[model samples]
Target chain A: MTPTLLGRIQTRWVLLWTIGLAWVLVVGPFLPLAGPSVGAVWLAGFRTLLIVSIVGTAWEFVYHGLQQLRWDKDWPTLFGLLVGLNEGAVAYVLLRNGLPLAIPGLTVAPFVWQFGTVWLVVWAVSNGPIRVLFPRWRFAGGRFW
Target chain B: MPRTLDPTDVPTVLGESDIARQGRRVLRRRFVTVGAGLGSLAMIHLWRLAGVADHALCAIGPLASPSDTYELLATNSQIPRHERLRSDSGSTIDAIWGWPGYALREAVEDSHPGSAIQALTEPVLHEFFTPKAGQVYRSVDREAARLGWSRVHQPGWVQMIRRAEGGGYWILAESLDDGPIAIAAEHVHVAIGYPGVQLLADLQQFRTDHPESGFRVANAYEAHGYIHDELLTRPSTVLVRGSGIVASRVLQRLLDDVEHNGAQTTVIHLFRTYVSDAQGDSPFFRRPAGNGFAYQPFNYPKSSWGGQLRARLETLDGEARAELIDGMGGTNTAPRRSWRRQLKRHEGRGTYRQMHGVVEKVVPTSDGVRTTIASADGTVATVDAAYVIDATGLQADPTTHPLYADLLARSGARRNPKGRLAVEPSFEVTGTRSGTGRLYASGAMTLGGHYAGVDSFLGLQYAALRIADDLAETGALPRIGPARSARGWLGWARNRRYDSNGVLA
Candidate 1:
């Protein structure tokens, strides 16, 4: 239950990053940008807050099972839903910033993008540092499936 | 809220902890049993803030199209006793055999104190009883007058609201009768019927939540009734679910329609359990006696004496009783003659089929509904039908009933796991201490609790008898003579009365 320094990053960092990125996509088009904007960037910021709250809550539950019931199966569902949401948010931010991206017609109003971000975060964190720093914490036998 | 501690603080008397006591109390009071434990859980969930908000939203929202007709209390109250029994025209259905005339007569003869009361009811009741279950309408005026029960003869929407304890209710009442003058008793017997019409409200909400998938998901009772009414107009294909009396009746209605109207309506039946035939031949293909087919009704010998044997077996332990029930069978097999005739007629006709499975989802096809039915083997088969009749079955979840919220709030009532009102063997709500106004319940609401089988007519009658006995124990039924001791005899007589005109009154 105790949180380590890096654990905090593992938990909170991606959530904030996903939200910050999603804000640029959802609000960029509507914001008062010099060339193309007519509305407020605040709209996107507000949406990012909502999307992040949903995505973060979902990821937290997956990374640490509800009340930390490790073997409980709800983690899979939580991971999947969050990862999908996170992916959409990433694509949206890339498109809004005019960065070269493979995703076509990127838009991120939906909360699905956060799902992907959380799913990846859980997979990486569970298998990465936690396994290396605390090998004992890793599930025994076959690679923490 | 913390559960009140046991009155007797003696450690020996306090057999259970506060939480366990609370759970048991809720179970006993709400009549929760193993079969219906989930319903009580759903009811508890409904009590949460989120649950209440969801229900409130449902109440104020525009109702979706009802899976079946919504029978309101006002319209039902207005239906005269005579007209309610038969179709609007009041003609007896001679087409179907075994009209229950003998049962109706037996019920009357058993009920009557003698000639006088018999004369008043026998003829009129006989006239009204018919094939359809709901049509047996009694004035309630007479029963109400005799029992001192208050009758709301013709209630409207406003009146129903008032009856629902103020306004803002969406429940459609078919009838509302208060038992003759209050016996100042603790228990109340509520018997509207299984899968009552009020369920339409819940169905409306379900359809609203899943609008894209909403198709013809009607209950067996309503669907069968509809088939009998508009046989020729039925869409080409139909899907019926659940393997119960209702399923059998629905098949009979469809087959009868094809026979009478020469229409081509394909019927597919669904069952949750796989029925293994001894000979691998459809039960319908075998003929039994003169004219009638020897269909092996489920629960076999027990179904023959379904009333007595079930009670006797339930007295045993779970494993023993399950063994007994297993020996009996879970689904009913139609009479050989009826199934044979229909089977032979529709064998190559491309009109009828029976399958055991469930629909995972229903998608609207351009021409009809494209349903994905998952069999027991995990095989998913797609069937396209112009209309989809759910006939799935009913849920006892208190959430399904409109009045549950009010009842729970006003009284510290908790639903049993079955989602119906839980009561003890004495039919008293658990957790309710003595002097809590004996609020007993009857009908399927108490199924899996003290009194099982509150769904069947025989079951209802048994429950009524039990309630009567309980009330008598408490000296509630002051007018009636000594309580009847022989439950089976009473049940037999009641069945006879329903049979007088081949229609149960």
Candidate 2:
């Protein structure tokens, strides 16, 4: 997708991802205070946890964001979430192959593959977490009990 | 604000003998008539909302007098005198403009200031301030009196509606007060609520098999006070078929009898597929309970009537609309906390028992109706109960109405994908648009039409308001400006009559 298309609106997942990355960067310097080798493994585990949380949270945003519209709260979206989970699996594989940042400068991929991997993460998060968390805001519609 | 009546349209004052039918009347000549209870109320509300003081509209239906229709539903449903309606306070049947709406009016009338304040501040409070069924009845009664309904309402059974010689349509009706009369009207709005709810097959079979037993079976629609009367005297078990609002209401009545009259009555709740958690997982729907009873807040979202959702529904095709309708369809009711608590108490006391099964057959027994049911776990058994209250809803098939069938045959009227009448966005029945005039249908009959909440109180209000605007656009009624609207609101507020047909008493 063109930057202009993505820039047109501040889609919820994109902002969530911005916050997530900012969090990781802020905490990255504190990893060594815990220990050396243990800290490295902990950082790897922390990154995986972030990926998982992002996957779970970002899918809703992607499903609604692709249509460039707000998600309808009443929509029975079990099928859509399943599809987002599938995309998250693919992102996890790409990250395993060292596409995304591994302690800042450790990506062993071509510029294009890295861009593709980042796009997939964005897509995954949008569909999963963002879509799940903030899909709708109508007060009168939806469940009463 | 009552209009000046023409000399030809003189009042028929019923003497002591005919006074029982107070709202019944005889009219020699009138330009048009739109019949039925809710439909007539809709027309009145529409005129008031638009601030149109008069029109050519008249109504001839079973609603003989003020509060007649309201009393029928409220009393039939066995709603206690002071009990609030199951729907939200926003759902109103009294006024069109709804300046204060139901909650505000009820709060004032019931003297519940906290409820009124809660309704104003916390919009999500479900049980904060709903109006009582009796209050609504009285409110409509007062409104009907003010609107000169006694003069305009002609008590009659509409046999059929056919095209007139040159223009408009002829309403063939046999008046209750006077004899057979015909009114040629430019527009006819049909709002017959429903044909009776069809009794279950097993009940029919049981009746046929054992004609001697004489145990009675009743549906929720009928005036089955005998069920309450019978239980009030002796101990009895009721096999209540169908799990909806009607079932709940029936149970409530039985419980009330048990509490006050020293009667012993048990409710047998039969279910087809008993989901363990009938309260569904979706945050968007107040789903039915595990006991096979609906517990939704209101019939539909507020947006279903006059908001963006309505506009969105209008944009979709018949198929898409039907799918959306299906998603929203099915039996549902408000989850009143008191009702839940009472039911829980009954369950603990062994007065209520739930079963998951479909009836294989029902045979007559010496004790009661012996019903053979097949359970979900492949178990089958036969049980007997004193009464069977079929709480299943009515059959709203458009073809069932003789007039609708005639309209379909004479005109090109058709059903939407949802098996209800297809209507234009203006609420005019799609195929019944004739020369310079139109035929409109409202309430449950217009279920598949542009509006989603067609059968709801607000839905009726919406249909009437839109139909009025559409009629005004076609030059059937006068244009309503700000001044006229304000006048109509004032008249309603002040308990003054502002007749839509421009006629006065």
Top-scoring candidate (DockQ): 2
Task: Give the runs in model 2 whose Cα sits over 4 Å from its true position.
Answer: A1-145, B1-33, B48-55, B121-128, B208-215, B278-291, B499-505
- Residue B344, candidate 2: how far off, in angstroms? 2.2
Q: lDDT of model 1 at residue A9?
A: 33
Q: Mind giving the per-residue lDDT tens digits that candidate 2 earns over A4-76?
A: 1222124424443464444334543343332345455346435644554455455545543442221122222
Q: Report the C-alpha lDDT of model 1 over B328-360, residue by residue, as the tens digit.
A: 333444333455567566756767666656657
Residue B63 of model 1, lDDT score: 17
TM-score of chain A considered alone, across all candidate predictions? 0.30, 0.31
Q: For each candidate, how many residue pairs have backbone atoms clashing (under 3 Å)?
A: 82, 27
List the global CA lDDT of all models.
0.36, 0.59
* TM-score of predicted structure 1: 0.44
